[model samples]
Target: MRSPFVQLLTARRFAPLFVTQFLGAFNDNLLKASLGIFVTYRLAEQSGLGASSLVMLAGGLFITPFFLFSGASGTLADRTDKATIARWVKLAEIGIMGLGAWGLWQQSIPLLLAALFGLGTHSTVFGPIKYALLPQHLGADELVAGNALIEAGTFLAILLGTILGGSVVLFDRGALVVGGVGVGCAIAGWITSRQIPPAPASVGPDAPRPRLLRDSLDVVQYVTSQSKLLLPALAVSWFWLFGATVVSGLPVLAKDVLFANEQVVTLMLALFAIGVGVGSILAERLLHGEVSARHVPLGGCVMAFCAVDLYLGSLGRPRATELAGAATFLREPGSWRILADLVGLAAGGGLFTVPLYAILQHESEPSHRARVIAANNIINALAMTVAAVVAAALLARGMTMGELLGLCGVATIPVIVITAWIVRRGLMKGVVRLVLRVLYRVEVDGLEHVRAALPHAVIAAN
Candidate 1:
């Protein structure tokens, strides 16, 4: 029997879309990584800014567009053919990358930063289209599998892009090489995008028009006003908060706490990303192609445990005499334990997210689904920014990274509880009744919705 991933990979419906998504993610991260390196090494001296500050500024630029544009993007996707928007987004990526390449070649920070913002906008537009388009392309049975493959592919692409970009930027003609890679990937993404079959709009002409400020506010209101949309949206945002914190913290954790070098930092990142990819695939297998949040609470538990364990592990580590590289870090006492915690945390995260995304797509009104997802994106961006600020605030207040991590671990409990509360409370604590009322004829005829909404089976006798 062929796996769903294999089947989907070969299917025209999914393959081209997958390639397009993978290449887009790869190209974005590649440009960002190379830009970061360039900023850190060559530009810091001339630009009168510290290397770390410049990198953070770059990150800010990249994230700003999602905050501002996701609502309009989502509205646009919901109002038109999603696949068409995707192709246009890809075409835009080529020009964005061209600008970025020129920025890199000329060592122009302004052009590079502008390119980053453009890339961010590109991502913002593509985000809702992909999620909203999936339900249209894949079957009920295949939605989980399709989402899994995309999630896995996305993280893997990010990992590879980061590694490749950082490595390629250190060469003699690094700028030129990096530029070529970025532009080439952009063109490739555009090519693959052209092959994606049409996913036309389901909503008719009366759909809401796009308004930048109003749309942003309206989308968020749409999400929060409905408990079903609200739950998954909040949960998704929480995951990003956790993810942004963990990923951002790795460098400091590696260099100072673990006394490890850049290689160790990369290794830690690989473990995190790969673990999420593994868990995404695992979620599909475990759920057997069912879309449900049944295991999300369990996944949250696992994540909490692993995060706390990591904090405990990092607490007593004996700092090395000098900076440790990958090999030495692996051999050090308590290293594997910490690494295991990283994997476990990320795996749990993977398990936690796939279903929530399914919920966002599965539960939403087809007419407004893209807008709902757009709202989620805005919330996610805010959550990540909050995570950065929270981390910075805690670290500045004399908390060690381990303690801050531990704080994050502790924070996970409420997020999990709140997610559960929303799931259960959103339905007024009557899972069975709610399931039958809301989802029975619509989605849960398959029973996945019932199993997903309730924590466990309820048995009552009068």
Candidate 2:
């Protein structure tokens, strides 16, 4: 644990929120993974659906709520106290998991899917509360670290919950075990949320009752109304699109392209998660806790190049009769190249996202911040859903997975350019600042000149 993380974790204001967020993330993934395995292994035959279809459906079920109900959820978060909403969401989790548990034990697919949707709604509502509360709880100096840690914790939680869900659900008593764990985490989340210091509603109580489509549009317009805020929102959405494409494709990429076994899927997942975690912490250190996107351009560049490497490295790989296990995959020198590229791709995520989120939290109006984040969440979910659809369509059209991923890389340059230009009103300026910030650690007033002037000095290049 880093010294600052230890301090924040031990402190009252941040620790409870942190723990609550972690448990919620863990619980969501845990159920999703359990349901995926349950549907695939247990019901594949009777359901008459392919593994991919069922699994993808399960994933979509988890995300559907965010797209559908974020309008109402975001409004609710702003009108009511955020901590109160967190507690209520956590409490709802317990009930949701209880239904999921019954569904698991009874092997009822519909019940399980319903609970899954319920869980998605729980997250949709909680999502706004989580990011919006950061500014209220932590000081400006701590924003980067706070967002970084959350991102790191979230990815790690997803990794661990996924592993546990996939592992435990294979047991004869898997249903009982998965259910118990979900309920336990939910209970703990509720308890932890209680300890969260009060964050009173910033929006007045007279706010109109949410009209789903209208409220969502208003929130999105609010986010895009500020030229600067649009960048973080768009950049965050793009990252999720890229991320969803990578993660969803990885299973097929591992089995079909790399001809690797199931454990290899787990291995690739760990590398990506750990890479993001490390990159997030590194971002905090480099920026010295200042909220800025100084490194975002560099992060996008790294992802672009590394994604191209992934496409190139995947070429001409030998096919195996039996999928290569993780051990065999690691033994090959060529595998190292693929692994490195995946890490770089994922690390770029942590680098760009932590700062952008910190910037969003720091810059938005306190009253409407939750709605803006809600809009971002909706955009992220929609973009990710699009990634899944596009990958499936292209793969069906005989596009190689490598070509598809390479397209993601090629597509990134424009996103970077457009977002950089929109956010900073200059593209080359962001790159120059990133370069300067990296090359020189020179102090101005004992603080690096990068942050507080995100695209500052543009180094006079552009």
Candidate 3:
């Protein structure tokens, strides 16, 4: 049988959206990674701050617009064809990339930051449209698989972007190259966006346009109306907090803790991205299409374990006078363990977040779905911002990157526990079945054995 992802790709409905989203992610990460490396190596001294601090700053800046514009994005998504919104966003990327190109070529930090903010706005505009489009186009049966594919494609794009972003900067006139890549990818994404089939408007044109303050209050009221939904949404946000901490910490972690160079940084990023992608794809099979928050507690526990392992692996290791290149780092003792920790952590993250996205899409009222997604984006952005701020503070206090990550891992436990407690009633199997209507359609071959062992047996299933 063809795999779910294969089937998704074969269908024209899903395939174009996938490519468009993939390209958008690739462009975002490529610009961010390149800017990060530049800030790390070339401009930290001029800025009078550490490279890690600068990275966190850039990350915070890039995500800030999501908080500011997500509500408006949601309004747009609900009000019009999602594909049209996506196209406009992608077209806007061309100008943003041009500004980034100029900023990079001139080594102008302020201009580059402006470009970053612009890119963030671009992403904010597209965020609600992308997730909201999925449920409209795919069946409930395909929700997990569809989301898995998007998550997988996205992180894989991140992986490639990280590698390319770091490698290209090693060349002469790397700034120009980074700028060129940004524009090219944006153009490609826009073209792909054009190919996406039009999505139906969730809100009719004659539907009264919501005022900004009203929109925000309405979303909050809707989210709070169902406290159960609120918890899952927060759980989703916590994933971003956890992920942003680890990813933003990696470059410094590689350089300071592992005593490695950009290539090793690239390796760490790619490994983590790969792991998340694998875990996202596997989530569909692991749960056997039974979508619920049942797997989240386990995933969070695994992430904590990996985080502790990472800390232990790097603790008390000697810092090298000269940074090790990727090859040399790979040969060092404890290198594989560190790699494993990164991968494991990312895999756990993938497991933790996918079900929540499915829940958000499948459970929310269709009329308010995009707005809910926008709420999610706002929460994700705020959580990431908090992570960045906390991480920055911890690093400024002379804490090692490993220790900060360990703290992040530890912090995750309570959030997961609290979220689990809030959604505990849904943890039961029967509740899960009810929560997810027609969750799965699986046929087991060995059912006769169970029947023979005990006729009319009381069986519990998900």
lDDT of each: 0.86, 0.86, 0.83
Off by over 4 Å in 3: 39-57, 210-214, 419-462
On TM-score, the leading prediction is 2
Candidate 2 regions off by >4 Å? 48-51, 422-442, 447-462
In order of appearance, the predictions have TM-scores of 0.91, 0.92, 0.87
Q: What range of 10 consecutive residues in model 2 has the weakest lDDT sum?
A: 442-451
Q: Please write out the lDDT profile of model 3 over residues 1-462, one tens digit for every residue.
A: 888888998888899899988988887888888888888888889988898777767877888777677777787788888998888999999999889889888887888888888988888878889899999998876888888888889889988877777678657999888889889988988898898889988887886574664665566667868865687788888888888788878988988888899788878888998889877877787665556777787678878889988999998777788999989988999999999999999998888888889999989888888989888888777788788778888899999999988887888889778756755776575455655655665444665566456766766776
Model 2 CA RMSD to the hidden true structure, in angstroms: 3.7
Clash totals in order:
0, 0, 0
Which residue window of length 10 is worst by lDDT in model 3?
Answer: 442-451
**What is the per-residue lDDT of model 1 for residues 353-386, given as tens digits with 9 covering 90 to 100?**
9888988899999888899989999999999999
**RMSD (Å) of each candidate, 1 decimal:** 5.5, 3.7, 5.5
